[model samples]
Target: MVSVLSPAEVKLPDGSSTDFANLDVAATAPCLDVVAEAVADLLPWYGSVHRGAGALAQRSTREYEQARETLYEHLGCGPGDAVVFTRNTTDALNLLAHVLPPGTTVVTFDVEHHANLLPWRTPVRIGTPRSPGEAVATLDEALRQVSGPVLVAVTAASNVTGELWPVRELAEVAHRHGARIAVDAAQLAPHAPVDMAALGADYVALSGHKVYAPFGAGVLAGRADWLDAAPPYLAGGGATAGVSADFAVRWHDGPARHEAGTPNLIGAVALATACRVLAGADLSAEAHLVARLRAGIARLPHVEELRLFDAAAPRVGIVSFAVLGRDPDELSTELGRDHAIGVRTGLFCAHPLTRRLLREAAGRLDPSAEPPGAAIRASLGIGTSEEHVDRLLAVLSAPLFGE
Candidate 1:
């Protein structure tokens, strides 16, 4: 079983205690028990990595390097690939953007999270497709149009709608056009297996916080040539091999070239431990739990579930919805204050996609005035339980807040 942190009991507005139903796992999953234990085990021997000659430093350095290898294996990266640790998914994608060769054109969809949407030099934004096949065709056409050093950036899963993209097919299209593809797997990695080599992706970025390791660590695993050739992400003592009195310095190659300064040793270990745990996890069980939650939500009246593709499209353990005649922000607050059910609200960092969905929902409602600006997202994962889903559905069905 996947042992996660015990849910905390929160006191409701009416002075009743209830276990916090954390349905916001897509934003930042709570730490796992094993990850906390790993941090405890490493704290005693903590030391500056790759610096001191003492036993503590040596042990810490070894563990840090081992964590890198663990992540590489978990992601199923190629032999020549390198894993560079960063603060989170945003940091990783920005690092890639900074290192891209000059005059590179990035082909991406406007529906991506801001982290993936931004940071590119010249982004050719693709229109939102109604289906997976349309998405693939749109990307193929866009890639064919762009010439010279093109990179295709895509999200493995929609953080807003939880729809999974056809990453392997997209990668094939990008390769056929002589371009490389980078996948933002922040939402996908937590609930599904992400094999970089199998997906034929040149790069993959994910966040630790979204995968039961909320210790401010993330990874960018892929080809090493561009990373090695680019300037160090941070210019510091650890990144330089030798420095002259006049300030001339030679930088180290490989992952160290991009990873400068003091590394997050504990965060890296926690992330690696989470990855190892997830590698052996039962994803199908989690999928079934998500399906149950979706079914419960479907039974609720006046609730419209948002989707980028068909209703039967395969998605991760996330569902976004808008309750008619109710403001999403107000409803989310009520869910937390009255029902002790935690969920996310608003555009969820995917403004374009959420806005489009809101417009569609409004058109279905009246085909007239402006669309609603926000929605609610209830995402599930290993930490979620059937009781939690039941509680949410029951609360939604009740007339507590006049819903």
Candidate 2:
């Protein structure tokens, strides 16, 4: 029996309703259904794929391969393109970093996650773009400085502030300079629609765990040549067609070249299933959730203090802020334990990005240090409800700021 209240009022575990300001869509139920459907095939050991001939194995293989095709179609990729499965976004970026021709310069911003920044092999530097306009100029200057085979790696949106980057503009800049762009769509893909070909990026990488499919599978989809020319990310039986007595070998083509071994058959299938489920959700409704969260946050007197990073930047579903006299860890733990609110805290793996935001606010990373510190990050997912938002803000209002 479905509840009478609108979908937003739907109740979830821990006694919270489904109207969380940050969640774009209610994904828990759908996610549960997806998991249930794939449960029979979920195995502890990696199953044989592509080479499996038995009925169950064949069915699983078909599902896994089909998942890749579905992802390509979902992202609107064209012919001659390919999608190689990886363990997660980290694996995907590492694969690209290694495959990039030697001495290839990579251009990106300082605000990007480590997954985007740490992978580049050549001239690893951060762009200082105080504002959006300055960001473009900064890239323009960097492009001018480098005249070689280049790769522009950037995040579609920031994980900390939920700030969306001008990926299209970045892609245009890269293309104008004869450089290719690869997007780290880990955070953005789960929240918004991401089309690699449409976004003008040479490649896009994302993880299934963040996308409601936490089965340890991810994808690197786009340009076929660079991946084809580069050696496989891993070497095993599946990647090679033949191994001779003299230790000679022949490799497989397309995704098989990079896949290398038995794939996460169930994980791939579930990610595709999750994507399909998300595609069917009302984006307009999701947009409503974002607006609601922003408005609610505005009601708090201290909320304005959190926007110090890029006040005018378009954000997705995250809000990071520093409390006057409270530790971010203490706040996050209390929210989870006392209020049952699940929010991420700390530097969020983008130390430089977090530092940039904190430095401007006169805050310290560790409050007990010589100087008191960093900020608290509240990230929302589709499973988050409105009550979770209200409760969090209410808890924040209870003298935690220490008047």
Candidate 3:
């Protein structure tokens, strides 16, 4: 089991303290105690990476590079692959977008998070499929029509619905039609194991904050050919190998090319530590907790669970829902103010999918004058327990603020 920090106490509106029940792990997870300890241990020796000659500098550089290798192996990447660190998953995907060869057509789904959806310049947007099989078939047909060097961008798991996507099958379909696939694994990596090479993915992006690291770091690991051929993602001192007096410069290849400025040594180390800890975690226990939470939610009458796929479909530790007569925003505020529960209530950065679910629930799309429809999401993680789930359900079932 992964050890996390103790439950934090929050001051309620009545000026009383209560143990905070965090249910917003989908946005950003709490840091692991092991990760925090790892970062604390390295602070004294933290110094310039790959530059200074001091003892601290040498140690820090070695630690930084070792973090890179640790993450590479954790993700099951091949020796030929290159892992480039970025600020977060958004930055990693944006870096990939900037490096695609000219005339390369990109294909993506409308149901994807905005981080994956908005990066490509002109992608052929596929509509949300009713089922995972339909998603694969749709992509197969789309890939057959594209001629040139094609790239397919997909999410390993739905950020809004928590439904798992058929990443391996999607990668196979993309490869059969001479296309490369990139996976946005920010939501998937925290709950389940993600292996880019094993999934046959050409590229994979994930965020550190979502995986119990809580550090501003992410990774884009994939084939080195396209990344090496493309210009440096950022041009600066570290990225360049030699600069001529005549205003000419030669850039370095591998991860350093994209990581131009001073890298986040601490963030990288924390993320790597998190990967190591989670790799050995018994995920079956986490799955059981998620099942218990889902079953409890299903027993509520007025609450309707939001899902693009069937309930039996494999999902991560997330469950989004809407009450029959209450605005999700108001309900979210009450949950935090009256009770000490923290949950996310919004489009969850997947506006297209959220709006579709809202329409399905209300039978009519909100007009332009009305506020945007939203849902309350209770996302679980390693830190979640049975008590947390029970408290949330109890509060939702009872009258809120004496309503």
Model 2, 211-266: lDDT tens digits are: 77767788898888888888878999778978899998787778888888778887
Question: Clashes per prediction?
Answer: 0, 9, 0
- Give lDDT tens digits, candidate 3, residues 122-169: 799998898999999999998888889899999999988899999999
Best by lDDT: 1
Candidate 2: give the clashing pairs. Answer: 19-385, 19-386, 20-385, 20-386, 364-372, 364-373, 364-374, 365-373, 365-374
Stretches of candidate 1 exceeding 4 Å from the true structure = 366-370, 398-403
Q: Tell me how candidate 2 scores on lDDT.
A: 0.71
Order the candidates by lDDT, highest first.
1, 3, 2
Candidate 3 Cα errors over 4 Å, as ranges: 363-372, 400-403
Model 3 TM-score on a 0 to 1 scale: 0.95
Q: Write one digit per residue (lDDT tens) for candidate 1, span 1-403.
A: 7778865689988888989899998998988899999999999999989999998999999999999999999898887899999999999999999889888999999899999998898999999899999999999888777798999999999999999999999999999999999999999998878899888899999999999999999999998888888888889878899899999999999888888889999999999999999989887877787788788777766666888899899999899887776777888898898888999998999898898897786666557646667988999988688899888888777574355
Q: Which wins on TM-score, candidate 2 or candidate 3? A: 3
Model 1 scores a TM of 0.97
- The list of candidate 2 runs beyond 4 A from truth reads 1-32, 39-47, 295-310, 363-372, 399-403
Please estimate how well model 1 matches the true structure, expressed as its whole-model Cα lDDT.
0.89
lDDT of each: 0.89, 0.71, 0.88
